[model samples]
Target chain A: MITITGLQKRFGKLAVLRGIDLNIAPGKVTAIVGPNGSGKTTLIKTLLGLVRPDSGTISLAGVSLNGDPSYREMIGYMPQAGKFPENLTVSEVLRLVKDVRRHSGPLDEALFEQFQLAESLNKPIRTLSGGTRQKLSATIAFLFRPEILILDEPTAGLDPVASAQLKDKICRERDGGRTVILTSHIMSEIEALSDILVFLQDGKVFYNGTLAAMIHSSGETRLERAIARLMEGGDAA
Target chain B: MNTTTVRIIKFEFSDVLRSKWVLIYGLFFFLLTETLFRFGGTSARVMLSLSNVVLIIVPLICIVYGTIYLYNAREFMELMLAQPLRRRSLFGGLYSGLVIPLNLSFLVGVGLPFLLHGVERTAHLQAFSMLLLAGVFLTLIFIALAFLISTAYEDKMKGLGIAILSWLLFSVAYDGVMLSLIYRFSDYPLEKAVIALTLLNPVDLARTLLLMQLDIAALMGYTGAVFELFFGSIMGAAISLAALSLWVICPMWLGLRQFRRKDF
Candidate 1:
């Protein structure tokens, strides 16, 4: 389980995450839905320790993740636009990751077979399409079966079938007693995938709970309308 | 954990070894050294001045090697940090890895030839030891500087620009400043002025040390005693080596600290 409390981050007077708090349970998919520049990526990066929090503490399983980077081993991260070395072949990049982790074999082959990455393993990353690169990233993120999976805009370049295939993989990881925190601007994807919905606006958690509760509280059936209502000040505005 | 550091260093070295850029740089350096050696026969004294030339070139290799090393290993560094390794281990590993292969190549390209046909056995051994020491000091200093610059700039071009500018300031520009100071202080005791200048510049200090070891101090006139005081006695050598080691370590510690606090 990942527990974040009073997480505050800023970039030269531009506050990104301001006094944000959230609890992510194990065996559940938590999707953070927010507008553009709403600190979705910042929050995820901070959680992964890529960005430092100015004034808050992030605890994973009762230990503070402030300085102890070893906690990251239990976490797997996929950036919004995942960047890898353009010169590296797909298989070479994965091998580097696996070698670092010393988990070279015993990878779950479901995505490997499903995405048909076997054929293109020798291709340089620069030659791969955006969708194919995303597939490679998704497979690597799930390769280790990390206790915490943080994916940012995972399906942005994915085809409809590939998107569906990835969602199925995420669901399986969650079902296998892992916590997945995914961020996407797509309302339909969040509604389909998220058990817990975190609505963020201007770097603060405006609302947090189940997707059904988010829909019902705003008196709206759709998740997007609920997010819009919550961002417009949660009935106070 | 130390082994993990070694592993990281080994991986970085191997990856860099396979890079076309690294290969190109290595070949360029080898050719540069050979050209200098082949064309540098103005006098026996000039041929003997290879030690000072090597001192200057050592840091250049370190700068180029280190700047490219960190830049190319961006993804790998991130991956390593995400693993269970400590900051010190990774750093130590990288430091040793870059130093070993680079110094070994320098020995092969420069040291062997100088030893084989050019110098006496004892002189060759002293020259080799001096080059190794110079390599260590230069590698440590430049790698730390490169790491600090790499961490400071998110843009690759900006970081490279900063690194090259830094190298210039320490190398040619620094020599210019020392020359100007000597000219300006021509009335003063020249030896004191030289000592002050060498103390101020690590590269010059290294050059002076190597020159003194090669017994070419007479070329610089009466100002040679300034270096002799620092390189003549065992105690003096120990003190100079200690100072060089400090130069190696302090910047690295600062760079590592900055990296630890860095958001990226």
Candidate 2:
């Protein structure tokens, strides 16, 4: 489980995360849904300790990560647009990641096979298409079976089939009692995979609950309309 | 210090070894050293001049090889940073990984041929010390400077420009400026001025130390006193080492701070 309290982050005078507080439950897929500039990425980076919040406390599994990096061991992250050195082959990249993760258990081969990365494992990362690179990033994120997986736009460049495969994998991972956090603008993806929908608007959580509760309370069958009504209304009632 | 940090260094070093560019540059450097030896004079003094050639190539190897290594490892760096590894350990590991192999290769590449030619044991020992010191100091200074530049600029070209400017300042421009100062102050007590100026550039200090070790300070005329002042006394060597150690520590400390605060 991940807990955030009084998280206030700012770049100059423009506040990105404004005293936000939330709890990310373990073994659940929590989707932070918001448009661009909604502070989703900043929130994720802060949680990962990649960015420092002006005032806040972030803890994973009851251990605070502020100014301490031990929490990174249980966390796996895949950025929105994964950038990799062009010269490294896929296998080499994996090996490099593996080298960094010394105390982790055996490699998660199931994730690799599910993504079908074996055939293209020897190819240079630069030669892989956008979809393949996303697949690679996804594979790397889940390879160590980390307790918490934070994925940013995991399906952005993936084909429909690949995206579906990844969604299924994410659901399976969550079902197996692992924490997963994802952000995507694709409504169908949110509708399909999110156990809890976190509606972020203007740097605050407007809503947080299951899709069933959101749709039932908002009096709409469509997830988009429920989100629109929630946005029309106010913060997480 | 941590095992994870050591593992990171081990893999980073392995990755650096696998680079074709690093291998190519190392080979080219070896060839250039050999060429300087083969086409030049055949006297013992010229044979000793190979030390000079070694001094020049060692620093160049340190700078170019290290700068390229950091730039090449950006992705891997990000990946590692996301892991449980400490920032200090990651940077420290990279610094060590770069220095060890290049220094070893440098020793074997130049020191081997010199020994094969049956150079005296004392001469070989001094030359070995100078070569190792030059390679180590140059590697640390440039690696620290390169880390600073890499974090200062987002673009690789800008980072490279910062690195080249730093190299130029340390390599040639600094000595030129010191000479100009020495000329203007020829009438004043210039000995201490020269001593102060020598502390500004480690590369020049290393060169003067190595050259003077071979008893070739006659090449620099009256200015050789600056070399003798630093590399001459026990006190001078201590002061020079302290100053050079600062050159390694300060920039790396600042770079790590900047990297931690960076938005990446």
Interface RMSD of each: 2.4, 1.9
DockQ of 1: 0.50
* Candidate 1 local lDDT, residue B149: 84
What's candidate 2's i-RMS value? 1.9
**lDDT (10s digit) by residue, model 2, range A1-237:** 988889988987898898878999889999999767889999998887777888888888988885667778788899898777777889988887787777545777776897789999899988999888888888888888888999999999998888888898899899999999999988888899988888777778777888789899988999988877776675444
All candidates: TM-score of chain A: 0.95, 0.94
Model 1 ranges with Cα > 4 A deviation: A234-237, B24-47, B115-118, B189-196, B221-224, B229-235
Positional deviation of B189 in candidate 2, in angstroms?
Answer: 1.4
Docking class for model 2 is: medium
Give each model's whole-structure lDDT: 0.74, 0.76
lDDT of 1 by residue, B53-95 (tens): 6656767767766777677767656656655556666667776
Worst 10 contiguous positions by lDDT, candidate 2 chain B:
B40-49
- TM-score list, all predictions: 0.90, 0.89
